[model samples]
Target: MGIVTSLLPFSIRCEPDGDVLCAHLAKGNRQIDELREQPPTSVLFHGPQGYVSPSWYATKREHGRVVPTWNFVVVQVWGTPTIRDDVQWLREQIEELTNAAEKGFRMPWKVADAPEDFIQAQMKGIVGLEIPVSRIEGKRKLSQNQPDRNQAGVIAGLRETGQEALADAVAEGRRQPDDFSLAK
Candidate 1:
């Protein structure tokens, strides 16, 4: 939250009115689903996901059966986004973020350590967008509905497909046992 994106893989900022400034960095081919003319203030950042085995479906007729599925955890925040025009503020904010990200590291990089000219040039090419949260929500779709055995099956299947993240999330969600459960 401070300012470092390195610890966290990526982040994006857009405007309050959904007007401008949104960046997306995921898999090289991951799509950026936002219209340019309309910048959405609801910025969504995701971490990881893996496949959920269909065997996890509680409604399944039998175990070790047909197709599989996927599960994941995601976060979405909506707010008024502002574009920072003050260069000084942007620099300070970026520095703060960097320090926060590197707080636990033994040797953290410092903005001041870089040459002034190089820093200025780098700053010139980049812009900052402010996103103030007005609404925040978390969505974690997992296999809570499945029986313990099926949940294990899903985890196994996810591991097999190399989608361990998704499998792990579904497994965790199942441990909670709640409404909107994905058992079906």
Candidate 2:
């Protein structure tokens, strides 16, 4: 099978019922076709990621040996995707996804807010996906290999540049046990 990749918006929820990843794609999307043809697929979720300049490392000043690197957190999930065209299932998937995405807003929007016929028409133009995750891997590269002083410098630099999420990840990485590996 050929490799096919598509950037899709998705959500994951784990509950007693089941743990599944959900996403919707426009009707006739090639990625959906590929998934139907080749059941096995991998979904990559990207977390905070950014460039870390060598200047952010304290060792850069000590010996000019530091090189630029990227700091990021990402998760890869492998599974066979199941496509759903049932309107009810699609509606529930979209509503749940919308609710999660809008939770932080003071005035959240609901799928029900739209006209019933309009919502039905929209749903017809899309398909829902359910991926039962089989294997998962995560990686966090956050200056974990650097000295404590260098890590602190990286955090300060990231924060100074308004990369708060990445800065926070770097701080969290330092709190991990000494035996913690960058990838798991």
Per-residue lDDT of model 1, residues 81-163, tens digit only: 45544678668666766776788989998889899999887776555555555566677667665567777777777778787
Candidate 2 whole-model C-alpha lDDT, 0 to 1 = 0.85
* Pairs that collide, model 2: none
Give one digit per residue, the lDDT tens place, for model 2 in 38-144.
Answer: 47788888889999999988889899988999988887887779888889889998999899989999999999999999999999999998887767778888898
Give the best candidate by lDDT: 2
Per-candidate TM vs. native?
Answer: 0.62, 0.90
Q: Please give the lDDT score for candidate 1.
A: 0.57
* Candidate 2: segments with Cα more than 4 A from true spot: 15-18, 177-184
Query: Model 1, 159: alpha-carbon shift in Å?
Result: 4.5
Q: Report the number of the highest-TM-score candidate.
A: 2
